[model samples]
Target: MDIAFFTDRRNDLGESPVWDARRGWLWWVDIRLNRILAADALGVVQREWTYSQPVGSIGLAMGGKVLVAAFADHFALIADDGHAQPIVAPDIGEGAIRFNDGKADRQGRFLSGTMQHGGQAEALAGVWRLERGGSATRLETGMKLANSICFSPCGHWLYLSDTLEGVIRRYAYDPETGALGPREAFFDCNTIGAAPDGATVDSEGRLWAALVTRQQIGCISPEGELLRTIDLPVPFPACPAFGGADMATLYVTTIADSGHKLKSDHPDAGRMLAITGLGARGIAEAIYHT
Candidate 1:
């Protein structure tokens, strides 16, 4: 697959590339910049929303709104005007915990997880499930960095990754009950000397994971075998999502190298990228019903 630059705009911490099929737009967040950006498939900025605090991730909600996981454990329903209606306030007590990567499940429940700021190991952050009426349930705990929270195309498995642990685990999913069974080791990023970041499942049940330090996306089979690797121009590719009308266009977001030397070496580190002609189709993102 040939990789191409999608946008010149750089993000300090670009993560969570979400395809809004209803609006035909791609949405993502710059966690360090505290901003959410929406752009067309051609990389034209259509709308931008700035927040007072870091905005970790976003998922499409019912009635044309968005479910936002804001910094410091704030989850809200945000309108186009950037007005956020409080949904749930999870109390993650002290020590630099914030929402990181999240999305909606097939059953329309919003699922999000948290991580320790500055990559320090404090308490184990947790993954949460938000119901329609604004009630939050802790799904999984004991994770230092929770990421790559996505489900299989059939919603039969839930994938979760701990970047610090350098492993991705899979759990049997109950779509009707919104429950996750015992987790089994799915993939080991340590094998490639990389940390697994954000990820998505393609229509064929293949898992595409961003190997942050390796500057590539690793495609793996459901049985945890490495299938292929897509090299990236940037050093820290944070996340990937399948977009475009046919859902074959793979969109990637990267992190900006903060140091002057690294930034000078990789100027395009934080830019968005698109991989085309891969012939891989993606399932529609599940919508948050609440």
Candidate 2:
């Protein structure tokens, strides 16, 4: 099957797209616009909420709330009622960082990363985990920009994208503690894009990555083999998630930037795409309770 259609919800720098199984909604974010986006199954915008500050990604909270990554504050819990609370704050010293693409492990812990918006690489920007009761712990560090992050089907490996570094690395992970071991290069997309943006694991344990700069989506095997490349009409295919009732629909979020001059070419640049017949169910992303 081919791409069904594209919807221009006009997302400004859309970053992450997640499928809320319980609510049957797609939760995503437009970082530059500082807004959270919710959409129905048909790719129609259901509701949009403005944030006090830019939010990178959102995690499902236990009490019908969401754990959000704040660019200025640390970690904030935004309730379904629209109230938000600060849960954790990072000491970046000079400049502030925004939480980027994040996902939960199979064990249900929230794991997210940070970007050094106006700082140095040694600033120790990396992924962190929010344990029960909102306890925070650092998982990895010394990365320029952290984007796509997901766990393997067996929970034995973690695929993390360093956009600036142009490498998507895989690390051995401890499923029980959510600890990441040493990292090894999985796939290097330097020839095409700056780096991989967001990725999701299929039920068969394969990874599908949104190749940001190249305007393509890559289907890679667990062994780091490039299986397929589907070109996108948009300039920046920011993030992709496998969702829909049967998890057969591949929902992708694209960014049409003034800097990239993409608007003149693909009018639907800042839109979402629903590519059906993926013929695969993805592993359920973990949810947070506290």
Candidate 3:
């Protein structure tokens, strides 16, 4: 697939790339930049907001406000007016971990993951769930790098990717109770420099995972079969999303210099990517506000 160059001003660490269907725009964050940005379909910067703290992820909440995974302090409620309020702070004693890539499930619960900083072991990270006007609950614990948190089209299955162990585990989810069942190996990525980061589910229930170091996104079937692969223009593709009015456009985000820290050539490393003709089923996009 051919990708249209959006911008060459790469981000130091671009992540959690999502499409806000209600606003018809793409929203993403530069973790190192401490900034949240929105852009039009044509890759035009429509709006931007800088945060005093590092924002790991952003998703639509029950109200008009947005839910943010504040890296250091805790989860924040970001109003449309650009105001931020801490909803839940990390309880370090009870395994206080920094929030990472997260999204909203169909049942209106915020599904986010956490990573322990300061040289903590990989097993300390976890995936948490937050309901409206409720407390945060840990869904899965002992995760290496709890990233790539997403739900299937039917909302019956939840996918979590651990970049460190390069494993994508699936859990049977009860949407009504927001409960997760036994964990099973969904997909095992054991290739060198091909760890799974962020993921998205297509309308067909197919999983598309971003392999950061290998510079390609893996398209796997629900039965855990490798269907095909899409080559990316640059290495370190952070996340992927299907957007456009029909949800046919495949949008991807990459990390330019975070790991290898590319020095020369290909300045579009950290910028987002748009690819057409993917010919895959795309799930419906969600918004935080009703």
Candidate 4:
């Protein structure tokens, strides 16, 4: 598929591509830069917001606000005016841990995962669920790089990836009670020599995952079969989201290579990419309940 540039500016670690249907804009974050950006469908800059600490990911919430997983240490609700209110603050003791990738579940509960900063090997990282009334619960633990958090279209399964291990796992999910059963190995990327970074489910229930090291996105059948791959110009595609007027466009966020070398080698390494004519549509993103 042909990829088009959606942004000129580059991000050090651009992750978390989300579509704000209510505002008709695409939103994403530059994790290292601690900035959140919103742009129009035509790749025009609409607005930019920055926070005091690294903003890992964002989930659309009611009242024109966004639920933010900030600095991997806390969760907050941020408004368009840049005002924020603390929701849940988990004490991740002094270590190299911080939030990385996340999204809302089918039932509007916000879920985020943590990663060891600088790729350090630490067992403190894990996945968390932010309950409706500002409560936090640890869902999974003993992870190094938690990523690729997405739910099945039927809302019956939850998928997560441990990038460091190069494997993605699936869990039986309860949309109503936010309960997750034991995880089972879904796909192993080791054979492909790549790690799964981020993912999203399409309207047809196919899982599209960003293979960061392989420079492509893999579309897997709901039954865990390899379906197809979408090649990208850059080497590090951090995350993918389905957006656009008809939700047929696939938006991807990439990160700059080590020492920003890809900025010269690829040029489009950190810029957002929009892929169209994919012959598939995306399910609407679930809004976070306050």
Candidate 5:
């Protein structure tokens, strides 16, 4: 119900956010800044690591000291001291194809999707799964702007969406086989005139989606009903995560000026934000087992 600024510095395009329960720190990425950052609970940026390629998204590792990251063209395990171990380079094709939103499933497999820079109609993007021993597999294809990826707490459902399609699809997940059953159109963001961006699941199994095109965060019930919408302070919210000691605080990342190729000077546009008093708690994010 209340949106508060969490950080002072602005992020050009902040994306995926994950909370590390072991360290009580929140980690996120500035997609265009080519960096991964971790902040303490008090909003102090503890670690800022920059790389040659963009850090598309990040996931917690089993020990909580190392992080699993989805780089622009590959996946890597980054240590607390900023050391990076290059993992397998997924076959995402060439030219403008790069990784985007990603999250680890309940089974400890890291799942990330790619986005084609200019091929919206071709649907050249896909979702890939990475196992503990560094094995990779392409699970699904035919996506445009891969976003809104998360799994239910019970590990039975996986949610995914392409920002350009305006539709979020839910897949029946089989953890043992690492296979996804046929997907069904779970919810249409077009109904709200907003495209869903990065999303997460609450302990109650509700999906909280960042409505990028609109200045709002939409919460949908597990049955695919839009339960309510929360007003956002900025126009382009990139993602949301549940953190804090109690997992009751909702943190959101945003896009500042030059976002979507547009320019604006809203003071709080690109800063990290926190929302509280919602009385909702979140399930612990699945860690990527090494």
Candidate 6:
């Protein structure tokens, strides 16, 4: 696997890479900076936007004109001009929890998870589903450091994780009603000595998960088997998404080692990487509707 730099800037907590094939741009967030950025295929930042709150993750909306983002406190629609349009404010597990990693399902419903700063020892973290019309609903509870949110290509399954437990659970998803069935164990990162951070499913239904602390990306099959791992030089790869001219390149977001749970010094920790020769194609990210 050949990994190359995608951008010159370092992100404290870079995540949620989304590719817009129609526009030939890549979008992602720098959580610590509360910034969202869009870059060209060559990694030149063409446009940048900032927000008042930490941007946990972003889902494209209005054909990439607006971004559906999970701000630390609430969900909002952010425009190219940096104007934030308020959306439904769901309960953020009281004051201790703030919204984190989010993804839009095939049907365009946005789902986000709330997590405690340290962990879920407080037992207040939860997953939420937000509809296009500003209606939000609780999907799952009893979580900690939720991440790795992605759905099956057919929209019948959803994979989410509570990073503290190093496990990603699969649930039977209701695409029509935005309902989730009981969750069952899907993939465990314990085997790799890491925790699941973020993930995305490819067009072939294979799940590519960023295994934080392990310095690698793990690919799993639809049957929940760890197929293989792509090693990285950095210590904490926070998120992974497939994008590029052919949608075969894997773009990864990373966390700075200086800011990791077990902080250390690593020069390349916060930089983003574009990996090639993965031999996988990705589905276009589902944009948030309305």
lDDT of each: 0.84, 0.77, 0.76, 0.85, 0.88, 0.85
Cα RMSD to native, each candidate? 2.0, 2.3, 2.5, 1.9, 1.4, 1.6
What would the per-residue lDDT of candidate 5 be over residues 169-265, giving only the tens digit for each residue? 9999998888889979999999989899899999999999999888888899999999999988777888999999999999999888523563448
- Model 1 alpha-carbon drift over 4 Å, by segment: 118-122, 257-265
What are the per-residue Cα lDDT tens digits for candidate 4 across 11-110? 7788899998877899998887888888987788887878788888888888657545555589998877767788878765466778879999988889
- The predicted structure with the larger TM-score, 2 or 4, is 4
Q: Per-residue alpha-carbon lDDT of model 1 for 1-290, expressed as tens digits?
A: 78999877888888888998888899998887888898987889988888888887888887767645545477888888877787878876466778889878888888888987555555578788887677888899888888998999889899999888999999998998887899789998998898999999899999999998888999999888999998888788889999999999999999885222224247677999999987698888988886
lDDT of 3 by residue, 185-217 (tens): 898887434788889999999999998768899
Q: In model 6, which runs have C-alpha deviations exceeding 4 angstroms? A: 118-120, 257-262
Please report the candidate that would top lDDT against the real structure: 5
- Candidate 6, pairs of clashing residues: none
What's the residue-level lDDT of 115 in candidate 3? 72
The weakest ten consecutive residues by lDDT in model 4 span: 257-266
The TM-score of candidate 4 is 0.95
Q: Enumerate clash totals for all models, in the order shown.
A: 0, 0, 3, 1, 0, 0
Determine which window of 10 residues in candidate 6 has minimal summed lDDT.
257-266
TM-score, one value per model: 0.95, 0.91, 0.91, 0.95, 0.97, 0.96
| lDDT of prediction 5 | 0.88
List, residue by residue over 1-290, the lDDT tens digit for candidate 6.
Answer: 68898989787888889998867899999887888998999999987887777888889888545789888878888877878887878766566568889899999989988778753356778788878787888888888778889999999999999998899899999889877888899987887787899999999999999988888999999999999998898778889988988999999988884243744368877889999988899999888997
Scored by Cα lDDT, where does model 4 land?
Answer: 0.85
